[model samples]
Target chain A: MDDYRELKPEDLVEDPAFRAWVYHGTGAEAWNEWVNEHPDHAQAADLARNILASVRGELDSFPGSEVKNRVQRILESLDAGRSGTHPADRSANHRDRRLWWQAAAAGLVLAAGLGALIYTRLPEAPAEKKSVAFVRAPGTSDQTHLEIVNDSESPRLVNLPDGSSVLLKRASGIRFPRQFAVAKREVELSGEAFFEVKKNPEHPFFVYAGQMVTRVIGTSFTIRSYQSDATAKIRVKTGKVSVWAAETVLTASQEPSTGIQELVLEPNQQAEFSRSDLKFALLENDRPEVAPIPIEQMSFEFRRTAVSDVFEAIRTAYQVDIRYDAGLLRRCSVTASLGDEPLTEKLNMICEVIGATYREKNGKIYIEAGGCE
Target chain B: MRPKLILQEDPVSPLWQLLCSGDKDAFGQITENCYKPLYHYGTKFTDDRELIKDCLQDLFLDIWEKRAHLSGVANPRPYLFQAFRNNLLRRTRRVSRFSEIGAEDELEFSSFSYEAEWIHRETEAGLEQKLQLVMKQLPKRQREALYLRYYENLTYEEIADVMGLRRQAVANYLQYGIQKLRDYWQQVVISLVLLLAS
Candidate 1:
């Protein structure tokens, strides 16, 4: 602290950027170091304090709605640029799925050899069974027709057949086969819907949303053909989906650039077709989408998956949160294959079984694990 | 004045996850949500709406592109404000761009009636006015860094991602920026204090 006392007034006058420099450049450690060393530099510290106060005042004045709206707009523009109409990599989706299945089978066989007892215990409590649950809101009945009509609300979700689900954002309704179409699975949706399709190579799932039709062999995808919005969009998560608007198909297409476009999506590559512009744009590809590969075959793993990361993944995948003390996240690790589990079930299983504390806060489930007890 | 509706909290927020996944939604959400603040931040530097919009758009896009590789983020809001600042710096760096604009030229812009709606008493209003004057002298990048870091409260990593620099570089920029501000403002404060005493 004495170091700052000896500093000349000129030293403070000459440097204005030190506040942010010490705070960000050297982390809390260096910032504290500077404050301790220069305790008597009251003028310097006061200036920094004033500037921070003003900035905080401004930010505090900023409305949260502005933040949400800004984020939405940026997403929309980027979505416009990197839509589905970009060039299609027809074979990439198929190639990856085949590779995953093969790897999973091989890993399982190897694991069985090493631990016979573990292999024998596997079927006792089925992982997939636990993952699957009836995620019904205060409903009419389990057998009654489940309809989520988002007339007043933004969007609602519904589970479709073949172990997949659909989130119908506001003003959307989807009807699926009671038990899934035997040969060709189909769903009729009027509005925006995100689909996580179950892989059934023998039975292709088809979505008849609007003037557009999306067909998938087996993949995870999100479709936003919201009835109100002019544009219809689709982003593939895993496997491949073939999408065709009114007149075009990616395969054996007739009219080139001018006509309505078609696209086949690879994992992480999105395909969006807007009816207004009647064109498409493909976004730059991201790293890769992680789907349900065999647990034994897991290679890309987070050493100790940060609780924050887990919370984010769950929220994104299911649009829910297991809220907890933000500070407690530093000590938590969640190791699990993020398969096709609904958001609530995953959180419930993770928090409840672990003896962690969790409850709904403003419609979000917050969980506290390590330090809670 | 800012819209009252802007303060309401969204319940089922998925945008944070989208940011983590480097999804395009994250970018879109920022553009939609932060347009007003970014626009205003730009206006603080230059009243040119088109320029502000352009800078913000590019900044948001770049943030989206680099999201996957972005590390050490506890939040995204501050990161975005930082991005807005960096974009302003890159654009303003072309000396000719600044030389062309005149202070007298009035640009028709959207009134932040939302801000005006909040009636401030005399002393608070005076402080705000003084603060604005202090902010005006800050170098473009430093102003941005300070705004995003302290105002929006972004982490160093987020600032680095937005500014296209390493963590240390962001620290240097911010530190240097803050140091300058402190010295510059001290004279203003001293004069005011002495005048009051006299």
Candidate 2:
């Protein structure tokens, strides 16, 4: 107690008793009594407490799935060693078990090779083959089905045949028909992509990624479904999107099982589907603080902004490549307040003001004007 | 803000006893309980996630294999930390093979940017970056001591055991670390005031 009278702020910070009292609410009476007796030391004590609490930071943590996966691998490896081996000589048993497992795997591969050979020789069903060919032909065969893979580090823009567009992230790919069917628009996605579907109520758009299917009538949303990830996520930016497990729609003979749940996500809502558990979880708020969706945060309102700047802003927001004569549009400026409209509508308004006509071809937007007199 | 340390009694001692008596479920519980904190602590040494994960696997496997002889140990948290730190350093040394790795190696601390109510008002504006810079400049041993004491909420004795330092030396490191931060903060406050006056 006497020593506390001579201690500085730094000394108080170093004392475990003081820290335990301040941080964990332990030994509160003793510290309060000391502070009341020596009122002058109160300021120093407060300063010391502030200093101790000031450096607030968070350590990066592993996702729960990843942690569980790692723990499971470790536990399984230990179990693999424990069976049919003396506990005292565990190191020797580990090597022997690995060798045994490898031999069993090799035998299975050999058996599968023979089975494949036998099955390929006995296939004879002309009617089934004809139906399969009809289903395989994408959008009446005149329209080629194309798959575009974004191999570069940046997001690659792919224009859909139905005026919709997709910003495919790195190492992602999307497959679509050259012309969408009149009844429905569909695309297969692997990895991650942000889709801006054109509004066409008669033709609903379907995105098949990982184990989940997201159906959107006309809206912008981001879907992240890497093959290696344990969970696939869909975040809605505008409008509503309904998501369901791929089995529910793809499995026609299953009679639509009641266990599979379909989640309808609104703006700023996200749905996460866990592959391991076969479960879907919905996050209602989906605030930007958790993960920022760029398209949602961008502003379309421009006040006397240069035509070229507006194009650049649009290009960045949609991650699409827009080609125009930069020199021609440099002097042209337009003042327009655009809100909630789709990308094409906003472009139409801007082009109308700037006296230029625009067209989309091969996923890129091109503008034509006579030097914008 | 960090979670308050449960200082009343050792939470893992009962689990450790069950593990010693060959309870597989107890081992799983212990691994789940300690995995996150141990993984966070391992990041201070290196940013190689795979390497840290490998060391973690090896540490737990070694503990499981040697559980029969480890029955005498009472406090499992500090003991686990001490073993984990040693295993990580040894693996890091073998991987790098250029510099001699030691306990004095520079420890990395994640920068502070998240907002909290407890952050003092005097050091609120533009102080997060400055605090990060000051923390980076501190000696590696002092930084490690401060992390174990404040963030992890370990007692001085526990920190000493984990860091392989004497109890008094642990106290000295904490005192020096806090003193450095206080001095740096005061300078920041004075400069801010001068800027406002001008």
Best by TM-score: 2
lDDT of 1 by residue, A1-373 (tens): 3352455433432233443332222132344345446445544444544444333222112234445654555556665774532223324232211111111112221111212222223455343221101111112122322434444333354556455656656445554546653456766555555666666788877775444567787656667664334466667666777776532111111112233356778766776666544456676655322222121122223345766776776555555545667685566676665453434445655565345767766757667567532
Per-residue lDDT of B94-188 in model 2, one digit per residue for the tens?
76665454433423443332212112222446775666567567767777788788757788999999999999999898877777867864554
Candidate 1: fraction of native contacts reproduced: 0.25
Largest lDDT belongs to which candidate?
2
lDDT against the true structure, per candidate, is: 0.48, 0.64
lDDT of 2 by residue, A1-373 (tens): 3444565767676666666755434554465557557666654575565455443233442445556776787788788874422223324223211111111112122212222222223345232211111111112222245667665667776768876767777656676777775567877776677888888888988886644777889888888876445688888878899887643111111111244577888988888887544478986557642344366566678898988888888888777779999887788897987644567777888889988899988878899876666
Which stretches of model 1 miss by more than 4 angstroms? A1-145, A151-155, A246-262, A274-302, A306-317, A320-332, A337-373, B1-198
Which residue runs does candidate 2 get wrong by more than 4 Å?
A: A1-58, A82-237, A240-345, A348-373, B1-10, B98-137, B193-198
- The digit string of per-residue lDDT tens for model 1 on B144-182 reads 565656644456787777656788977877777666655
Q: What's the distance in Å from true for residue B163, model 2? A: 1.0
TM-scores of the candidates are 0.29, 0.46
Query: In candidate 2, which residue pairs get closer than 3 Å at backbone N, Cα or C atoms, i.e. clash?
Result: none
